[model samples]
Target: MWLDAVDGYRHLTPESLKAAMPRCPRPVAWARALDDAIEFWGVTDIAMLLAQVGHESADLTRLVESLHYSAERLMAVWPSRFETYARASQFAGYPEKLANEVYGGRLGNIEPGDGWRFRGRGPLQLTGRYNYTAFATAIDDDAPIKTPQLVAEPIYGALSACWYFVTRVTPRASIEVATREINGGLIGLADRRRRYEQASRALEA
Candidate 1:
């Protein structure tokens, strides 16, 4: 069903993807998963899809969200809450601690460690326990809710990202809108647009 809808990348093969990005070659499995997920999610904007994955996952090299920050960095991320959360107020503290303080008890996080446990994962960088639960429900899997880290896998990561695009981003068809939805703002708008253009040309060729 999904493959039928993926007209743009219907002919996209692993060899072609490798050719497109020589610096970061993707395996056959990555190609298969990416193609299937894109097809399954019914995405038409190949450029946006490709660009998003490249930017979010660093061309699919990283799946886990790196939150490691010093107290000053943490304050920068959360100007109002740093003092509230960090007791010492010297070092911003560990990534896990910052995640817990910022993400805890919100976005569907119920338990004590829900924040760090369900931190961003996968090519799309899905974050928050609530969003993870939503993805799990959409796919009819409880594993993501129980162990959100599974979304970091290429197949699942690609699938979740596709889902997000189809549901939250496809309607707008604008990289700016998608960026705001994915990153919660226009943090990397310039880079995202650049990646989209690069992918559009590469995929077109």
Candidate 2:
């Protein structure tokens, strides 16, 4: 197993990774992909990375971001964009419109349908044209930019998440720091903390 070559992660088997993320549909694939990503990225904090993916994608169950939201949810999530209930209601239940309304004209999305086309995918919810382009370059492949949805695949998704953690997340010694770096806020601090602790324990087991 690839985990053996790493110092702290030598105990992690496919079964152990599966045990850490019970909801993962493809446990063996996830383990292998994670091994590849960790080795490629030189990721030492395996437990933290597992916690991040667990919280962000429900252990890889939700690779694509869901724009579907109620008026209240839309207002709460993006208060500046959806100022009032009536304003939020217009885009509610319409994912494309909502994505365009919020994500368009920013993050290097100047084209007509870039917002809907590049709406978050992968374990880390890789969003925006800028991110897709950078990720493509990091992987030395244009596939991420040409077909953004490819990040939703198990291997690419795991790689992308690990890449994001290594390059984007700063001072990621704790769950709170990683969450703030990734989410721009402690949106799911409790869940992230719980998952991080769970992964730490599982890695030892």
Candidate 3:
């Protein structure tokens, strides 16, 4: 089953993905990221990883919408410390900014001083400060340990998430475990388990 999914994904092209996710500009990059991680980690099936990304980002349109601005732009004005920041000049009330601050900031605003507060990032949406720190240390010491900027690099972002998936979750666990972790357990494990099963079939098909 896993092999079949991998075969299907190997034939996937940016055109098809773009048709599915028009707003996202980095379909090839996304695919390469997944491919590299799967190969490097010895993860047999790339399709499962792709399916998780699709599920998390709603086929990438919603993902790009959440990103809102270019990574370069976001990095240019990223806050350095614990301070309130606006989402963007156009978007009001800092909701998106707050979300970024919590999940992608230097130190999470909501769970100050708590190393476990890292939120969503990358394809697999790696979360929690401790997890982020671990990925940074593992990948590159120079890599920003607590910033969304780091995830802007597709390979690093995918690898970080992959590391967490292989290390923290079950070796056989489906994309659902990855989703649950990404959502910080807001979505129950049971629900995610069902998602994993469905996504697994999709990928395998």
Q: Is 1 or 3 the stronger prediction by lDDT?
A: 1
lDDT of 1 by residue, 1-205 (tens): 2244443446356665554444444557677777888667777876787777777777778889888776666666677776544552643547777677788988888889888998889888888988898888887778888877778876787789889878777464688888887777887788889888877677767
Best candidate (score: TM-score): 2
What are the per-residue Cα lDDT tens digits for candidate 2 across 1-205?
Answer: 2234543333356777887788989887778778778888888888888888888999889999889999999989899988999999999999999888899999989998899999999989999998888888888888888888889986778778989999877744677888888888999899988988888888887
Error of 3 at 62 (Å): 5.0
Candidate lDDT scores, in order, read 0.74, 0.84, 0.52
TM-score to native of every candidate shown: 0.85, 0.90, 0.53
User: In the order shown, what is each candidate's alpha-carbon RMSD?
Assistant: 3.4, 3.4, 9.2
Model 3 stretches with alpha carbons more than 4 Å out: 1-24, 61-92, 96-119, 174-205
Error of 3 at 66 (Å): 5.7
Provide the lowest-lDDT 10-residue window in model 3. Answer: 1-10
What is the clash count for each candidate, in the order shown?
2, 0, 2
